[model samples]
Target: MASLLLPIAAAFLLLRVILSATVIDDLRNLRPPPDFNSTIARNCHHNPSLRYCGNSRPLDEIFKFTIVASHLCNESRNPNCVESFDKIDLRGRPKIAPLYLSFDFFWKFCPLTIRSIDFSNNSLRGEFPTSVLACAQAEAIDFSHNELSGDFPVERLASMVNLTVLNLSYNHFSECKLSESLVFRRFNSSNFVHSGLIPNKQSFAVKAVFLMIGLPVMVILTVGFIAMMCFRRRNLSLETPQLRHHFTTSMLKAATSGFSSENLEEKSDGVDIYRGILRDGTHVRIEIYWSNISTEGMRKFIEECEVLVQLRHKNLVRVFGWCDDQELRAIVTKWTDRESLEMWLIERAPPLKHRLKVLAGVMEGMCYLHKSWPQVGYDLGTSSIILSENLEPLISRFEFDGRNSSAKSKFVYKHKFGVLLLEMITDRGKMGDVEAGKAGFIEHIRTSFTANWQNLLDERIMIASTTMEQARQAIEIGLACIDHSANEQLNMDWIRHILLRIYRASCHVNGSPTHGRFDGDRDKRHKHGP
Candidate 1:
């Protein structure tokens, strides 16, 4: 019986050994759950400076916490770094104490998975890190209440479409000249509160100071000076009758060949524009207003004449004189052989460089007018811009009557300029259909800008990488100009500067200077006539 029991025990022990071996084999074959701690541990080894809570905690939670806390906290400064991790909030966890981290160090070590960064109320000084522009996925950034200095990267920040919130107030930053793009317009004056933010305010303050000191003194001096000058002028006017150059009805009729079909260039709103040559062989265009003369109409015409006579710019058509006869009222101006922008665009497809030069010229003129005479408004449109013999753009037929017209609003000018830009790039004649309704125009541009703006570009023009970049920037500027929000519209100064930059870049791409000093033969090839 003892021998049988011993054999049974041996069999049982052998089975147990076989079962244990099989279990070990199965365990070896089956892979263990992935240990995230390995990756954390490797990163720690790679970066010796990186600190971790411990290897005891769950790997997933500790890894996420370490990534955030590593750059945010310095163990030397605050030994209780692990305790602060619990207070982390999605909105933003304000620092209880300042972090003495350089911009480069923070950005280099900060994980790309971070969605929000709040570095407010710190001493983060240095030039804005260009690396911040790479955080494409970052949504919110608060750099307010810091000692940041140098030129803020407003344009680059604006380009980040994913960025929704940005607070840059209370910083030691230099004046940031924000372009009137959708990104810059997203913030208000509140975003930028430092001195020199609004350039005009400084001049305005100086003017105010000068006015307070000099106004009374000048008023007294002017009262005495004007009285004497008025008496002398009254006597001179009575004696001389002020001989002025005026065109008579018969003279204009003769010049325009009695308003013949060949001479008639355009007739709109009871105004007939006739192309004519003067008796002295000078080419001219005669604008004859045929509407029945009303008191208001005559007053406005006189006011426009006064304003035009005072204005002199290379980009403005030279107004020779006006005809105010009882029967016919006309304005005589120098003729632009190259004709209106609308006609030139239809007849000749200019290269991007030439088109940008023309646009720059227009903006320069507009900027001048907007700055020198804020009260004066222009009737800006495609037909209103005329090209000179040298392909220079001139703003013509812009009459100011000392009244606010919708066309005079900076927003309106931006909209018109945007349409003109779109025309130049897309080869579209007019944006009448798009501008007919504001909603449709916005949606069209927004969609096209996002999906594929290249499709909208003119196929006639060859698109290189540099040229494509320029076109994309111009399209963005156009979109910003025509933004539905009035506040979003770029001021004439900003628009002019941006357009000039684009013009310079375009000229560089074409191997020319900012003024586009092309060869005589190339110039001749591009010249067109009405």
Candidate 2:
């Protein structure tokens, strides 16, 4: 019984194969059903896996598709039919017979709607087929193991946007007509074996070199270069910086017009900051606390100033002197007339270059504070950055960081400075009222950073698209600073350097004047802060 069953199954399979071939030949010669629906229904009944018909079921007319081979059209039976293909896929099928008609007319009038074509190992003969060009939408084409000859369409193949795979191996083809190395960058040598053509492999070799050897070396060299640059700049910035100066109470009072309310610029909860100009034409910002304050509060302020005066960078406000008289208690420093950074960001809507310059200066100031005094930073927000006459930023506040001297405290300043950076680029981020907390504000900014960076920009300022990209780096640095975990390492100096590079690029692109340095004349030039 087993031997009889084996013979019966073999006979059935052979009969099915012969019937399939006969059906295909009949399909070509005989007229198809009156419409595609009957044809698909019949095909599904015979073989469910035919084309797109799945599970032996025919689809509705809406989902029905037409496959026009262009060469196998029944002109007599379908005279009014459109010479167009909707879909076709013949994978792992039998070798194709010769075409029925010319494809020139169809190519001119109809769109070739093929997704892919596989004619590999077809035992085809003659030159490369021009009809293949008609299938412009084909993503993959296989013409390997054929007797195809003549100049291959190397130049034309490069123009196909969707064509990805091309197999021409074991073919007697001519030399590659392309001189550009990029034309065959995607293809491999095996695809053109035995043909007088070579794929451009230098790109892959170069990329491999970069990944394995060149990349690590480049990274090391880059890190060393930045370290060297930062070391030089840091030493230059700290060139024999002396301690603070002390002035008499009489001179401060004279400068502030007897500390009257008229000279007062800003009044905080327990602080009255008076803006004054010296007789020598030097402007000054005088800090004095009173009203709803105890002696301890004043003492803390003095102590904070003592720490601030010990260290100095060009970005920090220049401490001219403090008036420690018999009764008066005040800390004085060289001030800016243009007021705080908050005022400028909110009111002026400064252009990209100015904003970048401010950001770089602030980053520099923060880097110095974190590096020089690990247990220090500020907490007063954007109001802490006072602007000099040349519109340069000068950090004016300091937090002794006695409350939290952990690693978080060191990064807290970085995070705060990041917030300032976000504010610099955008105006619609209702940071305080809508997005209340630090994390909330950062989330709001993140949502605003859509594909279009232009929408979030402060439109009051004019800048080019490239400048806008630089502005994007500022926001990224801000977000990175805020989101970085305690364990994550960051390079504050490198960040500062990146910001300065952005400012310089923006300046060059926007055709703005160079950002000024804190020269000796900066002391001579008076500034009154907000």
Candidate 3:
């Protein structure tokens, strides 16, 4: 008995030693480092057995998702159970086929694990589940071609800060609550298609794609474009009249009346405005558009200046050149001593007939910019537009945004400005009862007036059109040019044609009277006349 016990003890000791030497350290080393943000919660399914998943050793070898799906659907015996995918390596796979994984079971396994969800054409029924809102980082949600009902749960979705696109097409959400903010409301009705929600053209997916694909390409293109522009501008600057003058600091000092306050036209955006004479004694206005801007700030301003330099039109105000020598920065433009139309309307009681003539000239200038030279609006409103010695209006101060290279036209900004013009003309030179330069004065004009043509027409101009149908046509066309929809607004080309007809008819209708008046008032009002 003693001999048998000794041999058994020896054998047990040997086995224990071998197991410790071979397996224990290997198992300790093989343990996975923890991932704190893993999709553990998403793997909860309608399965009780998967509750033990937390205890599984060699955990990487087990599929929590497959286990939950089988447990929920009671498909442990099915050959094509989600378990089939358990052994398949899914890393770096570019495509996910929806049919292979039953979405019902997929939801059961992990509802919020996905970053993108395209459940379109699923024939899924019922209201859009609020549970999906749990997916905080979801970027796109496509529920199109389904049977979803009820108003869009905007309140719930407001929490999804990163959600950029929400497609509910071919559904029944007719009276859904929506965000009225421009960022939210910019989407069109077409995104709600076939009684479903239509995606906005500026949808997150499109914007992201633009950012990811189009934006980088755009940046590359922009860099190349700006480089070429800088090269061309350098060449053009050498040939410009302002550069040819070879203006010296002393020359600028002498021209600016020693930078006197009396010569200052107006203070704007920290810029000092001075009426200057060039070295050749050519009169020109100089605006020392200065800022204590950081290096980045200066770059942005210079970029804007570069964009402005490309534009050329008679109706548009031209920047001759800029000076950035040393700590000083300045901009120069053609100076008109007559000032803006706004100043004239305020100070001088230019008669209604003369005012109409000024307005006609304004329209002519706008027509040339919008149609003839074929740049949209130069953003020329009352301030940017200058009047000549005879009160002829000229549009000025053309600006462009280099950052927005894809902006095809300035139609939207121009149409709003046109509406303001309508209000200005109709208000009979009386800007408002409010004090001049008050905030919201311009905005009040925009909002207070009705968009209807009759309501917007100036009573003064209305009297001018009486018994002159052609003048009436001119007023009608001017109103049309300011229509809110850019497509509906008349381009300068169409406006020019209309003005030609109006001119011809004016000659036929009031030609005799105008001629008679011209002959009578020739010496008093006009130096030269029929």
Candidate 4:
């Protein structure tokens, strides 16, 4: 009994030594309430030292506790280290106790209360801790930019139903390529390189579409608005008066779900768009204007909106209605389940056939817009173009017209106009020498830039002998549309003929007899020897 009592006393003393060990209380002072407002800081790693310290406001005191488990953390021979719960940084400041024993102690602890865990940009080693399996509430995890090895255990990740954002950027995840089905479920690819996870074809296309189309168009509409101010001096007299559409600030707030962050789209010219669904089961895209709108310009914008709403061409985006009451002005268009054409194109693989099809639809739409309306210069470039389910092109945002009906003047106009046409032809608007031009009026326009198209062709369009001629013809039409002299520019009537000829050439190359179904008149013309 004496021996047993002595052993028990020894164990009790060991426990006391651990429990009585001094902890740096100042560290605990950094704890914040669990409800820190999260603003998605993109590419947060850009400034690696810029630490995002969480709200230092303390959580309920009851949530605070310390356990003397440091001795158990002695997995290595490093004698200086203490056994304790693993410390995880919330934002930048360290919180959550150090891991006791192996990191597996995480399973025994934080699986319940912790909602977000960010272990990014650290020298964290080992495979992703399987202990996270117990984290039912773990919705967002940032394990990117770490020294983690091994394949991305996707099977384990997919099990986390609550996970909304999984950032796995800057890690050695190369062997673990993710499926299209996987990325489709995940939203943001915050730092997707080095993951070795090539997204499947469909996902690649979708992601490309989002980046290429969504980003470029957004940048153009945004930057073009500013760049276009330079042209204002030339067309000062041609400015149209905006129409009035007024709405109260209260109505605007209600429509936008109190201007929630989730609804927010791109911010341009002090305008914020919210993905708003109206009470009438109508999908209303809400755009809140911060800049001043002249009454005449507003009126003209409304008239254009109304005009577009009336048209039902296959390649045209249908506008439902506009609401301008109080301080809000919103336009309701038909809700497309598939996001945008730009988004679609950005994520898709390089295919000449698909590119041709997209151009053809856009050309058909432009033909209708210019010819059917007469005197209207359907300015369907850049931001105005969209894509459909079959990857067909659909034009949008045609409300803002240049207000100039006459032919363009000066070489600079020719260059800008040429770049615009090049985008339609090559599907790559990343302008370079082809757009900048060398010398003279012809050089400023695309008509003189045949060499540029050869360079700018998206590498995805495989160099197939079959599709070369059709692609060349398409390029020719784009050049024709942006002739140096405005009078030299082919009319839409003639442009449509060129487009049909290109389409016919594509059909011949592919030997696709089904092409006739798309154009009964073309089939008739062929039969009647056009």
Question: Which lDDT tens digits does candidate 4 get at residues 10-91?
Answer: 3543555576553333323323223312211221223333222232322222122222122222222235443222333332
Model 1 lDDT-worst window of ten: 521-530
User: Per-residue alpha-carbon lDDT of model 2 for 191-273, expressed as tens digits?
Assistant: 66765456437766999989999999999999999999889767763653323255677887899899888999888877789
Point out the higher-scoring one by TM-score: 2 or 4.
2
Whole-model alpha-carbon lDDT for candidate 1: 0.63
How many times do residue backbones clash in model 1?
A: 0
lDDT of each candidate versus the true structure: 0.63, 0.62, 0.51, 0.52
Tell me how far the alpha carbon of residue 79 in candidate 1 is from the true structure, in angstroms, after superposition.
99
Best by TM-score: 1
1-530 in candidate 1: lDDT tens per residue?
01222233234435545767542223212222255445556656666544342345444444333333432443223355432322212222233323223233334334455566555665566765566565566777667766677776666775677787767777666655445334556666566556234344767799998899889889989999999898977787455432233778898988989889999998888888899999999899898888778878887776666566566888888877788778978888888777788787667766776777788788878767766765676755778888986778998867564544244466666677877777677744233466545456556667777877876677655543347877888878777767666424446656666666776778788786536432221322211110
Ten contiguous residues minimizing lDDT sum, candidate 2: 521-530
Which of the predicted structures, 1 or 2, would earn the higher TM-score when compared with the native?
Answer: 1
TM-score to native of every candidate shown: 0.47, 0.46, 0.41, 0.43
Per-residue lDDT of candidate 3, residues 49-98 (tens digit): 44323544334322323333333222213355332222221212222222
